[model samples]
Target: MTANSQMVTIKGTRDGLTLRLNDQCSFDSILEELYDKLSVNGVDDGQPMIRVTIQLGKRYLTMDQKEMLKRIIREKQKLVVEHIESDVITKEEAFAWKENSEITPIVRTIRSGQLIEVKGDLLLLGDVNPGGKVIATGNIFIIGHLRGIAHAGFDGNEEAVISASYMKPNQLRIAGQLSRAPDQDAEGVYIECGFIDKQDDAIRISPLQDVLKQKPDLVSFERRMLNG
Candidate 1:
């Protein structure tokens, strides 16, 4: 998750000190850096209360992660936890965020704690376990079971879709909208596809074959992303 390209920028403004983390970097890395940078020079009798505006680029932090970050600052360094901001953008991968020309594939199962982000379509050759996550700017096609978090259209592409042989994903997100698996059993649904319904402004799921038939020319996903 720590890449050489992960750029961190800091700036001071009237609002406060803004630590801008590259959207491509993982949350863990950002948090570690935050602790290292802020804790190095400050901390006087638990009373500095420096105002910090943390900006998350294109990613949402889990409640636990947020709490932990606040704890590190508020308790460890005695700094007041100020506003947390995120520049939520429609995205692809951090490195390939600007391009719309690639199709990424995973040859094996995405295990627990593994996170994947891609610029174009994603083809998973294996199952996605419960703790795994797949986020793409385009579409997601799962050859096996999809039992984890799958986010499509991270770049706000309304035409992006998600499909799987067995669609039991923990959660599904397209653009800014998100939905979770229903509480009921999914044994009856063998194959499924999820797509954004631009007219209704919602993500809809249907039988895979039926969805394909509706867009017979969609076999080439890159073409669709470019043309549709």
Candidate 2:
């Protein structure tokens, strides 16, 4: 391929324009080619502002480099940056992503006054006795009873959910919403899940099976378990 083509690939999309930078090329080469290409065919002042999406495939750019890229594009006047995409991430970002995506499993029962917290999803193999508390930034799954306070999405993730085999929690909290188990006989309680009801923005309890319909991403956790 030509040097110009190898450095930067530009295409017109339905939304606007897409600029794909070659990951294998040096940043200087990319900048030179990109400047040349844009200078030759930059948008006209009379034309409407066009949204531009930059795709840096497997290429990592520093904040200054990103700003330079945006500045180069902005010089065209009629080109507005919609967003930037990249496949590469820093080690800290990778670690944070892993922490948020992975599920933490605990096999101990939480007694009264105990508190268990996890940065991500929590999978407890035992029960949470009354006065105990369980918290997770993501979803919470209890294989046994949950008679204590259970809070999922404690960091304000309204989409988080809490599920328990025996769903008689003293308090259920998803994000900022909170609800207490209804005052009823706990004789025939089965698997139950608690989530924030979008309609009312309140905590709602339903059969655990309903979670499949509400949050399909839960399937990924099941897949991880099966694969492991």
On the 0 to 100 scale, the lDDT of residue 196 in model 1 is 69
Tens digits of per-residue lDDT, candidate 1, 1-228, equal 355554555576775567677777677887777777666766578554567777777777766987887787676565565877776543444445546546776799998899989887888889999999999988888888889999988988767788988888889998888877656666753778888666777777888788888766457774654664
TM-score of candidate 1 versus the correct structure, residues matched by position: 0.51
lDDT by residue (117-214, candidate 2, tens digit) is: 99988999999999999999999999999999999998899989999988999999998888998777556657889988888878888888887798
- Which residue pairs clash in candidate 1? 90-155, 91-154, 91-155
**Steric clash pairs (candidate 2):** none
What's the count of clashing pairs in each model shown? 3, 0
CA shift at 197, candidate 2, in angstroms? 3.8
- The local distance difference test score of model 1 is 0.76
